[model samples]
Target chain A: MFTGLCAFPLTPFKDEQFDPVAFARIINNLTDAKVDAICAMGSTGLYPYLNNDERRTVAENAVALADGIPVMAGIGALRTRDVLHNADIVQRAGVNAVLLAPMSYHHLHDEEVYALYEKVTANLSVPLCVYENPNATNFTFSDELYQAISRLPNVAAVKIPGMPFGDKVQGEQRLARLRELVPDSLSIGVSADKFGVAGMRAGCDAWHSVLAGLFPKTVQCLIQAVRDGQGESAAMASDRLSPIWQLFVQSKGGLRVMATAADILGVCEGNCLPHPLKPLTGPARQELEAQLTSLQLD
Target chain B: MFTGLCAFPLTPFKDEQFDPVAFARIINNLTDAKVDAICAMGSTGLYPYLNNDERRTVAENAVALADGIPVMAGIGALRTRDVLHNADIVQRAGVNAVLLAPMSYHHLHDEEVYALYEKVTANLSVPLCVYENPNATNFTFSDELYQAISRLPNVAAVKIPGMPFGDKVQGEQRLARLRELVPDSLSIGVSADKFGVAGMRAGCDAWHSVLAGLFPKTVQCLIQAVRDGQGESAAMASDRLSPIWQLFVQSKGGLRVMATAADILGVCEGNCLPHPLKPLTGPARQELEAQLTSLQLD
Candidate 1:
């Protein structure tokens, strides 16, 4: 079973090139924090920006630095072949598993969604995890689709964002329903680092996070507090981290903000987003720095 | 000056793999048409489904088949690096220009959009064309951004889709306004085959189309009628081909429909959309066949 914190490192680029040394440094930092696994090339990692060659290089470096720890590569695209190609490359690099996100030019039906997982898993040697991030990807698979995908032989987990689905009662009901429906062998992970403790208390098996990439020790402590049933300590940790999370999420470009914060925290050398996404402005950067310091993360 | 008809060949796939031989055959057929150039790997070509190697191979085959005729490759992606990588590969394959779509991850500010084109053109040795297909790609670039992109040193043309902005008065006013603002050196091509005659009458320099891929003679006749000011004849051709266009557009999947139509016409061997997009079903196939017959393209 996959447990503990999973750190999703931001991909580093410099001078229109993938910076391997900077990537290595970030992975080393995560390793030092003893993160159970590393998820490379996720939305936070900007997988779409990396071509096949760059993705292969990143996968190789991540697998090497992971040093026996699990490395789950993000494999999702508008085209299934691109995903398959990336999966093949990452598999060759010795990554432990692949996290699949169903993204495309149009909304997909339940069967189409199931077929994607079925086809990918049929050819993949490693276990697969289904990621449901409806915000980044406009298309969200329905519960029926998720149930079908979860039943696939190679599917091992389902990762959901931790934000409340309207009311707390509905959120708890949905969680309880999913927990009851998903097979026991298929682990359930939450992608919400902001409410990691709360999600854990509500019964998520693991916390998948972006902030964990920058402050793994703090994230680890927060998770541990919840695990140990120390509610007050967990709340304090979450309170301290709230400002940083808000800064990262509310910045003009949310993903770009996380990349920039990673640079400020010394987790990566530079914060550069791919084309169409520019760096935060002077005022935005200054505001983010102020928030980071106020949260004592700087 | 890219005047007259421009054909974008559907990228051929056989048994789920890119069929370069079939792709070459389609290009060879377009040579007899009055097409000024051939566009390979555009959205009509199902570009996102192709892997990097397959993309390179398609470019290579397209260049070979076109002989001295210009072949432009679509190099748009969510990431600047992906676009650059594709541009580099296609340039190496001897493509004349790269058709670029602005970053579609989010609605972009003018400066950010300008920066994307500037960065791409800076690295590209070949000329580039700005493809404005806002209907398919949710993010649309403003007129100011298009004007700025046109001023870039290597930009050669702008490809606009057919849908009018509004009523006749508004449409005419908008076109007149654009003509006044945009320079004459940069040609504007229309990708609307259905409204080809109207667009030509409105002073568009060329027609970029998908229907032209299968029925070159009909498209050529339609273009000739428009050029000759035979409005009734051009309208007749448009009416005849309208059903085929509707079937292609209304089909469940864009790429799948094109590939299936190619297969039905015997231009390609089979439907080869990458995963997440399934082939046409029995009902869809029957409907497409009937539509093609009605258009006299079968």
Candidate 2:
């Protein structure tokens, strides 16, 4: 029954190690701000870059430090075995549901794809959500596939990526089609941070969000506005957050931008990313500060 | 100094474990076929999909099995610490050169990027090669940046990507410019397998190759033609292999198609990949077989 704004918090690191103290504070802030859910080890959390020990630590600390809020941990990898291994580790650490996306270097067959979810759901003791982010996974589940996966006993939710990196699904139609096809018991959430207002307004059960981690009030208010169907006010909030979305777009899908916004707002320390990825620099860094000041996230 | 046709073998996995026997066969085949170098853990080797233990094992096995061929190991990760950690493991395994790629989740600045190579190079008793594949790393090096990295104490070569995903740097000019700008002592190599003839004829000191792993005789033949500046024969050989290149292009940057090619030829059994990725399927599978038959690499 996962719903409302599912916050994806950025994993704060210090000295190239997962800093539990700093990360716990970020989780504490989001939970205190009263968001719907706190998700760690997401794309924003740099899950694929982490070692298993670090992932376990992040999941354990995020759940333990999130106070009473539901913590959904992403447990995806390039292989079914590794994905399950991470799922087992996180489930023991007490996450509500493990979010998954099957990432691969080659194109997968439809049957092979179906068997992956079947294998995971068959063994997972807890509920697991399907994260359909094609940009990273290169997989776009057909209507038939979605319907089939929904029947799996432990399937909890389906998170549709808001950023349409490829494939045809977009905007209101995507949410409508998913809501219609997937089993009603599964939560339907939108993950493109910039599109949260519109995604929520479109009747997505939740926003699997990155924005909420940086600007909780703005995102929480957007969630409430959409719930109330306050279209105009929600649009206004979307407009104000437009600058933030623009920065994410410029930075190529929001990780660096979110880190910059979080760093500027004193939400975290050290703008350094896990290397190869520096914090937003040059023009984009300047624009982030400008957007924060304008939106009053500063 | 690593030069000439460097073969990058695909990592074969069985039961989700690295199959050293299958990989050892591929390494022996390439060395026996007389490639200039045997590179383990390159992108073609599926390094990122591997665990550190698997990576170290592959590096050690490739080096020990390479016979007299120099072994270059790819030691890149999303973090500087991990890259160096991998470098240490690979260096102790007796690889000739460690190939460093600055892969990132965030955009990096030039100075920080330069420092990554410097750090890894400084710590090594042996040499390192700069792998500038922007499609994966998302970091584009300037002409100035290339010259700077080339001057590092242990920097041996710069492998520029032959497949231009975007921003257009595909042919002879790319090799010619880099050869002119990079330090004369530093080897200049082209990484696109399809363009071996053109890349070598364009003055690339080496072809860091995937084709050589499976079709070593054809690649070796092409290398000789180009080295002899027998341009017409090299072009003819590349033309016969054009269908093979077409399969790679259809598969998008060639890993799956090459893997399928190797698998079909019985270069290794259990043509398995890390998951999410399956073997080439449908029309592409048929075409791969036809191309192999035509090239006689079958």
Instruction: Indicate which candidate wins on DockQ.
Output: 1
Error of 1 at B102 (Å): 3.1
lDDT (Cα, 0-100) at B273 in candidate 1:
58
User: Model 2: per-residue lDDT, tens digit, B44-67?
Assistant: 888777777888898889878988
The per-model lDDT (C-alpha) reads 0.76, 0.77
TM-score of each: 0.85, 0.91
Extract clashing residue pairs from model 2.
Answer: A277-B106
Model 1 lDDT tens row, A1-298: 3688888887877776788877888888888888988999887787766777888998999999987779999988777767888899999999999998887555565667888888888898998989987666656767788778888878998888777522346657778888777788787888757767777767777888887766678778888888898966887778777666676566533566666776777655665555667656687777877877776641
Error of 1 at A219 (Å): 4.0
Model 1 C-alpha lDDT per residue in residues B1-298, reported as the tens digit of each score: 2678778788877777888777877888887664678889888786665668888999999888886778899988776667778889999999998898774544455677788789889998988888887655656667787777888989888888666622346555656766776787787877756666667667777787777776677677777887898967777767777666576566533455667777887777666555577667788778878877776761
Give the DockQ (2 decimals) of all models: 0.40, 0.39
lDDT score, candidate 1, position A53: 84
Worst 10 residues of 2 chain B by lDDT: B163-172
